[model samples]
Target: MGRVAGKVALVTGAGLGLGRASSLLLASEGARLVVSDIDEGLATHTAAEIVRGGGEALALRHDVSKPEDWSAAMAAIEQRFGRLDVLVNNAGIAIARNIEDTSLAEWRRTMAINLDGVFLGCQEGIKLMKKSGGGSIINLSSIDGVIGEADLAAYCASKGGVRTLTKAVAVHCAEQRYGIRCNSIHPGYIWTPQTENYLRDLGTLEQEKAKALSRHPIGFLGEPNDIAYMVLYLASDESKFVTGSEMVVDGGYLAV
Candidate 1:
């Protein structure tokens, strides 16, 4: 029952979707959770949920794209938890515009949240983890990072950057004997509010939903838990040998 008993983990964007799912699952399995989100209310709600479920949890207002915020978050975690064992760089945004149509602003925003955010989290997380004998770092990439789609240029680029960045960090940690493991997860189509918003922007809700479903041979969309379970494995000691690896939870979407 206690897959990660007594470990402390910080999850960015823990208030929503996959992040929320991962936080809940980790807490359920006996990990103390640092639930972070840009939205203070959502963060509080998530932490409250965990606590109500008789789990250890703390909520923090975190803007992952801001280096200063990362510093403050680390300070808070160190103060409250004394050490950190896991960092899930799960906070990200998607801009469904092709390169030509995507504005500079949009592209920059995507990179800031999706790519820069992960970079900052890793930097600060490594510092905390090293003090505690290292930990696991999971960066959430996407199937688009591996197989490109024309409309997802900016999103794809940021995720692709994350994919490679994870490997580089893994290599450095291993060579330095940091005991920390870094990996990336590439998820295909999981039904989340972000996807709903993206789908709304694409076209008719039902039509686009149907089209999206057709791409995945699994015959259905995924839930946040689909990705969360994998995050748990990576966060746990069971995956000790796993580092610098890309775990795909795309429901066979990448197969076709």
Candidate 2:
């Protein structure tokens, strides 16, 4: 049997990048998924792809930053699946700006989507999971959250918030016996389409790729699968004893 057989998962930002990859991987491992994104078309496309691959999936246009949307999503899940087993808070944005240059609006927007969104997902997901025994909550953080970057101040702050928030949620769940486990996954420079766009905008993809690889001791940038592997481990029953931890999938970037 698959590792996550008979489980149900909700993946935010499932339209692309690591979220899309995680949604696909989880489904491949036999989990029915609720793939949600701000873009309805993309969410629908992702769900269709899973179903085409003979996996079960549902598409929802959900803005994770909104509490009402979270309620609606939980309601939909309850009506259809009856229980939620996993929640992947993978919706985030990176604003390229130094501390001095970062606007207040940009900072708030980053916090809203990156930090507030994850908070809402965890809060609502925990409530539903409590009803069904317990569940896993995975927050997608970044290496920027662990270390520092030149022009990603707001992004760093938002992700750092996620790191601590995961711990707090884990503690609360454990104390309350909510049966919910919370953890954060910090990824280094993964070559997703978003990063590709950044490289393309630099007008020197080869140079950017070389620079990114040079930072990693592994001599190569990570792929979406790297993060997905960790997500799978944390989402499965195999990680029953693991909670309130930060799993780094950085290809040794943080090691050096």
Candidate 3:
């Protein structure tokens, strides 16, 4: 049997990138997936892929920053599966701007998706998970959450918020004996379509790749599967005791 066999999972921002990778991986491990994304087409396509692979999945158009969407998403999940077993809050936006260059609107938007989204997901996921006796909640953070970046003030703040919010949720669940575990996964420079766009904007994909590899002791940039594997582990019973922790999959970038 697969690691997460028979579980029900909801993954946000699952249209592409790390979120898509996580959804596919979880489904492969036998979890019935609810894949939601702002991009409806991508979400539907991903769900189709999962179904073709002999896994169960559903697609929903959802905007992670909105609480109404969260509520509706949960309601849909309940109607379809009757119970929720895992929630992966993986929707986020990255804006490369210094403190002075960042607009208030940009900052607020980032916080809404990256920080507020996690809070809402945890809150709703906990309520549903409690009914089922337990569940796993995984929040997607970044190396920026643990360290400082020159042009990523807002992104860093939002991720840092996620890191702390994850701990708070974990503590609350433990104190109330909810049998739920909450944790954050921090990744650094995983190559995704968005990252490709960033590299193209820089006009030097190879140079940027070289630079990213140089920072990591492993001498290679991480792939989407690298983060997906860690997420699957956290979602599975294999990480039963892992709560309120920050699992870094940074290719040793943080170690140095």
Candidate 4:
């Protein structure tokens, strides 16, 4: 139960879905949490839930795409918990569009949130994590990042950026002997609010969901906790030797 006990973890996009699940699980495992989301109310709600579950948590409104927001969030973390040991750069958005249909503005916006956000988080997180003698950085990529989707061009591009960026960060930290480990998580069609919205937009949620299910050789979609457990493992000292790796929790989706 105390897998991450005594650690300070910050999860961006902690308001809902995988972020919410990860926050709850990490808190239950005894990590003090900094729950940050663009939506202040959602972040507060998640934080309150953590506290109710007998965990320590602080909620803050943070826009991950903004450098100033990153500075403010780091400052707040320093003021509250003093150091951050685990960082989950989980804030992202999905735009369902083909390459030809995706406008430049749409591409820019996707990159800003999904790619740029993680970049900023890693950059800022490294500074504070170094102060605390090292930590783990978990960046959420997707199976689409490893493969391709005709309708998710921008999302694929952004997540692909995250996948590579994680490796780069891991290598740099290792070379500098900062004791920080960085890794990317590639998840399949997890049944989250994000996926729900994406499928709904594609018309006939049930049919789209079935199509998604058929793509996974495991025969079903994933739940939030499916990914949360992976987050827990990476956050714990058990993965001390693991770094710069791609952890795929895609229910055998890539196999087919």
Better of 2 and 4 by lDDT: 4
- The 0-to-1 C-alpha lDDT of every candidate, in the order given, reads 0.95, 0.93, 0.91, 0.97
- List pairs with backbone clashes in candidate 1: none
The parts of candidate 3 lying over 4 Å away from their true place are: 200-203
Report model 4's TM-score to 2 decimal places: 0.99
Worst 10 residues of 2 by lDDT: 194-203
- Winner of 1 and 4 under lDDT: 4
**Would you give me the overall lDDT of model 1?**
0.95
Give candidates' CA RMSD values in order: 0.6, 1.2, 1.2, 0.5
Worst 10 residues of 3 by lDDT: 194-203
Better of 1 and 3 by TM-score: 1
Over the stretch 122-235, how does candidate 2's per-residue lDDT look in tens digits? 999998999889999999988888898867899999999999999999999999999999999999989998777766654589997788889999888899988998999999
lDDT of 1 by residue, 1-256 (tens): 7999999999999999999999999999999999999998999999999999999999999999999999999999999999999999999998779889999999999999999999999999999999999999999999988878888899999999999999999999999999999999999899999999889889998999999999989999999999999999999999999999999998799998
- Per-candidate clashes come to 0, 0, 0, 0
